[model samples]
Target: MKKIVSVAVSAALALSLAACSSKEKASSDKESSKDPVTISFASWTLGTEKEQNLERLMIKAFEEKNPDIKVKIDESISTSDWNGTLSAAASGGKMPDVFALPQIPLALSNNWLMDITKMTEKDKDFAKISKAVRDSATYNGKVYAVPYAQHFLGYFVNKDLFNDANLDYPEYGPSLQEFTDAVKKVTNINKGIAGLNNPFSISDWYPAAANKDMGWYTYKDGQYSLDSKEFIKGVNLAKEFATNGYTYETLTDEQKANFKGENPEEVWLQGGVAVKWDGTWAAPQDASFDWDFIGIPGGRTVVTNDFVGISKSSKHPEEAYKFAKWMSFGKEGFMKRMKIADEKGKMMNTLPVSTDKDVLDEFFSIQDVPGIRTAYDNLDNAIVEPVKIIPGYVDARFEGQTGVKAGDNENATVGQLMDSFVKGDLKVEDYAKQLDQMADQKTKEAMDSLNK
Candidate 1:
């Protein structure tokens, strides 16, 4: 028998959904046509203490609405382990009925989750959903999941830092040269500070380095396309940042410690860093500093979907679907989450996956964040983050990119990295060949699974 219990969202407990809810379950005698069911989900954003509390409260509200259904949400810590967990769950019989999936077509092609094409066809709001997001979730003409939010990449500037340097704040969208000049004008390494420190790590840089349309990474045929011209440009920019002292390619232990001690954004907040390129979520406020946002140069915006899908092994597939739908589209579920996050001083960070006019207005107005609004306004030019969808492809790509750690080639330029990859220096195929090959392999993998 499945376990039945209640724990408060406030009580100290394991971060996983296995913990009980504290909210009082609504007393309802009316029984559903089916037995009670547990729908599990893993939250990618539930890492911080604030996120944990918010996640629990929102989940409890969902349970209260649907008295007949019990929802169990687990917060996964290691993003690296998340895919493995989902794959293992699918292979075993314990996969959560409702869970998160990358909002990429390659991921949807894995065939381990529920399909949402019919739902899309029936919902009038589907017309409002962004084509980029829908296309990212659709594979072979079938929509497999619902996206919860959309995120974009941009430069989060420190208003104080710019002011201290006597530099004018950037407008809505600035060119690469303009951005670089700002970084140079404000940077001062002798003061144990920088104009900006965009993470040199793979996760932080790849999206911006990708093509403005297809992104830096794409797995289409059976290969990869990390060496495209757009990708090279991104790399060059990264190289320039390091060489120009805007970023630290290699931080000493002491420097790293110093960086940790001074919140980089606080550094900007206090007139240290001039700009920080990252997701829309990194804004930090200060009484002494003024800050504003601008779109990244080249009109580049990397939009990714945080999505929900039903597991094939789910015992309550219908209930799971309903819960996932509620989480994405249901009132007081997703919209409430955006409001709560914003009120808590977090970025009302994510753009709604739905096209609800009211929800968009509510979210954007609530936060008044610039980079996010810019992305939404220019979503027509946004491209999905390139991710490999063949079950193990992400792992492979992660290995390859991460193995070539940032700044490993201090003497080499970003152009060199691209040229090396382009010339098959890494034994990866040429750009076009790689994309076509990966796409073919993905198609074959999806077909192979059906025959099984």
Candidate 2:
């Protein structure tokens, strides 16, 4: 009886051991099925609601197609505060898997980005991307970033208004005053037409032949001068533009209401305004007006979207590469993204930076939109706006440093400081002096950071 009980216990133990081995083998096989990866991405911003939505949808689609990978988004750093945010992340040694490179060269030199040249070469979509875009992402003989889009900002004008006023359309070359005078002459609000659309205010939109030389930024070398006599002329030109009923603040309550909605640029599309200064992307495709655009007066600045780079800190570098490639190289994936914007009835304003024959074919397949060809032409002298392009410069801007109460009214702020002189509350010389002081302060701050 004792032997029989011991044998029975041993048999049960063997059965339990067999069950454990099978469970372990099944777990190992599941783990080996596919390597799972989760990557974190950061950018200054995804921009408008449509843009934010587009990213979410794109990520969802990517994950659906590639189930082994997942993406986490971190957009807490506004472009205005991107430099500081990135610095803090670096200090914590917890940088994102992918991020923006506002200072591309600085990031590359610091080993913050990884070289993805081999992966890019292997990707089918990379083969179709535009050389200009691919070149921007290349650093030190290696591809460190992914070029997404090219954008252009300038003036979109109503051809009918120019014709009605017997004024020649603003094209290649025109003095700032020439443009302002034309806007004034065309203004006849009683006739239900505004000579210009200054919905956002009247600062950089005023084209100054002088700005062609100033180039918007005060780089470290300091060869350019905001206090230069030429620059003052440009600032005064902006003031004159406001004085001539060219600003949106001068519009009636009824006219103002037309632009209160989210997409106010549509007011121009309705044929109520003759001139609007905005990014070329604001121009809608289905507008029923006769419109054309000219590059911003200086034509020196070119607008491009922030580039995507892989973080050196990324543990899943290959997976991060796959993420970047999926977004850029996979045409169908991107086309799916564009479809979201299309459904939202928004102008993408960004042209594809890929020369891939199929992608270009897909891009142009959409009915040709106006101002796009012109925006491309403007890219000939592509450059950057110091205040808009560079991250820290805004904190140093006149109005940005000093709040609205400094010299602004409730109606507008973009040109309100300049408007103060136009309204005779201030002197042009004082305005110029104020600008000089601001520029000097900014330069000093920039210099200190560089020395550090």
Candidate 3:
């Protein structure tokens, strides 16, 4: 009878311990549920005071809406060393939850990005983003990043210089010939005023301007036509501009000696250059004279975009996605950003990727630069700068993937071939075919590597 009593007491003790353990787990889970998740965000743009403040304001607004999530700004990453910094972070398993993408191909190759296709598909606002912008972040039919901001590649005209020359300001979309003629008319070698700056980017702009369907370097159908007639024409035009007095690069030694300013290189800012090939973000904030922006010769232009992505190593992906959307294409976030800019009486340097009417309306109201609206309107026809998307583009263009040397210089790369042509050391017709072949082969190799 005593033995039976002992067994009953032991069973009772086991039951009590099990119940206590279950209750403890339930209490711990409740506490964990209430704990806010914090995600880290890093951006090179945060190096600037104005941009940092703007981002902080946006973050504050985001936090107000998302009380369960917190964003911590990671300032250790910087513009000059962003790539190296990110590489180190990725290797150490300490990659920020969200960060700006300095190179999309690098990010994709390293598997740094998370597959956010599902999140984007479920997001109604994402559909409102421009197709080209969306396509820029997509690789192999998968979305890995989002275009956070963009700047249009075009001409920034000095109105004062145009009026002084008695020449009408070039309209928004001038033909190549019209643009060339205007450049000639505006140039006054005797006065040290150049019609255009050294148009090094003629090769980039000419083909696109000449052919509406072609992108930079005549990229189409996943191949480059660097040796095409259109490309040769662009190269010849660049050579012609340099040979003539229209561009600063071809100016005579005498002309340089007789330049009108203490710093002849400062001609653009001194209002001595009629039109400068540059990006919209380079627009002068407080100029001594009036200025306006216009698209490059053709109706089509190039756009440089900065992208953002959620890190694959992020522990809180859902929260990270919410923050990334708010800072990128989300309409509500854009509205709040515009509100902040308006209140501060400052203009945003980056253009919105969203096509939402309300977002655009707010953005345009705050960005009242001359001809800016028309420039924005032309985005429908613009091509994104290729190096950001095309695999091995940087290698083919800059890193000597072609193994072709310039002239007899065994160490020279395919990129230097253009400079040689412009300088009259190499003939465009002599090497166009070779360059086309090299570009195609290198690009194919890159694509194949990616597939593998």
lDDT of each: 0.58, 0.61, 0.80
Candidate with top TM-score is 3
Candidate 3, residue 345: lDDT: 62
Summarize candidate 1's per-residue lDDT along 171-232 as a digit string, tens digits.
Answer: 65666567667777777677656766653432233444343434434433334455455444
| TM-score ranking, best first | 3, 1, 2
Candidate 1's TM-score reads 0.69
Rank order (by lDDT, best first): 3, 2, 1
Give a tens-digit lDDT track for model 3, residues 205-296: 78888987788888876888888889999988888877777887567778866465555347677777788888888887677888877778
lDDT comparing candidate 1 with the true structure: 0.58
Q: Best by lDDT, which number?
A: 3
The parts of candidate 3 lying over 4 Å away from their true place are: 1-33, 48-52, 76-78, 249-253, 260-265, 345-347, 401-409
Model 2: per-residue Cα lDDT over 123-174, one tens digit each: 8778676454465566446787776555556677778877877888676334
Which residue pairs clash in candidate 2? 128-356, 130-354, 130-355, 281-349, 302-383
Model 2: residue 329 alpha-carbon error in angstroms: 8.0
Which run of 10 residues does model 1 get worst, by summed lDDT? 20-29
TM-score of 3: 0.87
